[model samples]
Structures are given as C-alpha cells and as structure tokens.
Target chain A: GAGVSQSPRYKVAKRGQDVALRCDPISGHVSLFWYQQALGQGPEFLTYFQNEAQLDKSGLPSDRFFAERPEGSVSTLKIQRTQQEDSAVYLCASSPDRVVPISGNTIYFGEGSWLTVV
Target chain B: SQQGEEDPQALSIQEGENATMNCSYKTSINNLQWYRQNSGRGLVHLILIRSNEREKHSGRLRVTLDTSKKSSSLLITASRAADTASYFCATYFSGSARQLTFGSGTQLTVLP
Candidate 1:
C-alpha cells in the first residue's frame, strides 16, 4: 500500500467481548505505532514497534490491551474483555526511519478503526 | 500520560484569517510535530520543529518552538474553509525512536 492501512474501519462490540484491529504499515517502513483517540481528544500513544520488536508498551492503559507485529509489517492490536472505556478510534502510523539530525521522521497515519463498546 | 496540552479548545474564524494554536509540554523533547485531523478520521502530518530550531515555515504554516519554555505554537496563515480541522502537537523524546506523545488538540473552524 502507498500508505498505512487499517482494517474494519468501524467495529461495534458488546462489553466483555474481545476484538482485534489490524494495521498494515507502509511497505519497508521500519517503525510502526498505535494510538487511541477518544472523542474530542488527541490520539494517545498505545504501543510502538521497531520492525518485529515491541519496543514500548507503556501506554497500553491496561493488561487487556495487547499488540504484536510478528513479521515486521502487519500489526494487530487485541483487546480482551473490552470495556466501555475501550471505545475509541484506534489509529495506526508508520515512519520510514527513526529520528535523526538531518532527516525528519514523519509518520503517515491510517484512517483508523472506530471501536464502540456497547 | 499526555506530554502536550493545547490552548483554546475551540476556535472559529473567517476564511483568510490566520489561525494560531499553542501547545505546551512538560519535559525535554528531541522534536515536536504538528498534525491535522479532519472530522474523526486519520491525522495528517503538518510540520516538525527540532529542539535546536526556533522557527520553521512550510507553505502557509509556521511553527515555532521554545525549548526553554517547553512550548510550541503553530500559525496557519491565510486559512481557508478547507483548513477547518483539529490540530495536535506531538513530542518525541531524545532517546525514543519515533514514538510520539500527543496533546489534546485544538478544534479550528474556518467560516466561509
């Protein structure tokens, strides 16, 4: 894909149900990120992957949230026992490289997956 | 936790007027970036300002960063109705790879 792609643009799940969101980053991109945005708020950081390594998961919010990028390209964010608070738009982004002095690392974002926990 | 916070939760202005949004952060950052979101969809990257650079301009957008104050401001000149969107400021720490911590954001409405 020319840009980051996310699946199931919108999902409605009942409370306690599990859900999975998928993201396919730009081809050959080295960095991928996941963010959650609530209504009228900015996207909050969830996790980051450098290729296949899960480097940071500090912002996952809780143990119910899990993310993996096994092959260093496609990534999935899984939420177990979803709660009402889990309702938000899940955004996926990818950057070509890490931050360096001369080159700016600009991330391209996907349209996002809107999850509604009923 | 959120690293940046934007001011003027909402702003309304006529087309052609300049729109200015401010963002403040708590800690040191390697770089700061601005992003725009239309409706509730994806975010588009606007510009980036490094810690050493004080100001940068791209097209009609101007970004200023003050490391001492731990803040940055985005100025969109000659705004148009198409520019109506929510603007966010995100920060990346020095050692962090490319991960960004974003602020709440400011909703800007351009009246035609």
Candidate 2:
C-alpha cells in the first residue's frame, strides 16, 4: 500500500456491542501505534508495537480496550461492551524504525476509523 | 496525559500573512514534531526538530526548538487559504515507549 490503511472508516455500535477496527501499516515498517482522538482534541496514545511484539499497552483506557499486531503488518483494536464515552476516532500510525530518525524522522498516519457508541 | 500545550487556540489570518504557533512541554524530549490536519481526519507530518537542534526549515514551514525553555514554535510563511487547518505539536520522549504525546492543537484559518 502507498500509506497506512485503516478499515471501517466509520462504525456505529450499540452500548453493549463489541467492535473491531483494523489497520494496515506501510510495508516493512518496524513500529506501529494506535491512538484515540476525541472531538476537538488531539490524538492520545493507546498502544505501540515493535514488529510482532506488543511493547506498550499502558495507554489503553480500560480492560475492554485491546490491540494486537499479529504479523507485524496489520493490527486490530477491539473494544468490548462499547460505551458512549468510547465514541471517538481511532487512529493508527507507523514509523520506519524503532529509533527515531534524525534526518527524516516522521510517522505516517491512517485516515482513522470513527467509532460511535450509541 | 498530554505533555505538550499549544497557545493561540484559534488563529485567523489573511492569506499571504505569516502564522505562528507556540507549544510548551514539561518533560525532557528527544524531539518535537509538527503535524497538520484537515477536516479532522488523518494528520500530515510537517517538520521535526531535535532537542539539540535549535531550528529547522522545510519548504514554507520553519520550526524552532528551545530545550532550555522546553518550548517550540512553528512559523508558516506566506500562508494561503489552503493552509487553513489545525496544527499540532507532538513530543517524543527518549525513554518512553515510542509514543508521541500531542498537544490540543491550534486551529488556523487563512482567509482568502
């Protein structure tokens, strides 16, 4: 793919329903990240992946929030028993390497999946 | 929690004028990055300045980082109507898990 791709650009779920969002990062990118952005706010960190290893999950808001990057190329963020407070835009980003690049360091972002919990 | 805080929450400027946005952070950071968003969708990376580097330039965008003050500024020269969007400042900590903490952002409106 030319850039980071995300699935289900928009999703509306019931209060107790479970929803899953997917992300496809750039080819061979070593780092993947997930973030949640509320209305009129900047994106907040959710989780990070270094290849297939899940290095950080501290940013996950609750036990219902889970993310996985199985093959290191594609990732999924699942929310169980969605709440109205969970309504937000879920963003996925990718970087070329583990260490920040001094010359051309930049992270690519997906269009994001907007989730609405009714 | 967000580490960066941006000033001038909303900016309205005429096209061809310059726009400046400021950001401040609490902790030591490896680098600071600027990003732009249109229609509240994906973010586009604008420029990045390392902690050791004082200033950097990319096209019409100029970024300055002052580690001593723990603050940074982004300047857009000769802004156009197309430049009307939200701009954000993100900080990357050296020891943290590759997470980029972002500020609330500044909404810039370049009127034609």
lDDT of 2 by residue, A1-118 (tens): 9999999999999999999999999999999999999988889999999999999899999999999998888999999999999999999999888745334358999999999999
Every model's TM-score? 0.95, 0.96
Give the clashing pairs for model 1: none
Q: What would the DockQ be for model 2?
A: 0.60
Off by over 4 Å in 1: A99-104, B94-98
- What is the C-alpha DockQ of each candidate? 0.60, 0.60
The per-candidate TM-score of the B chain, in the order shown, comes to 0.95, 0.96
Instruction: List model 1 lDDT by residue over A2-101, tens digit each.
Output: 8899998999999999999999999999989899999988898899888999988988999999999999999999999999999999999998885352
Worst 10 residues of 1 chain B by lDDT: B92-101
Which CAPRI quality tier does the interface of model 1 achieve? medium
Which candidate number would show the highest TM-score if scored against the true structure? 2
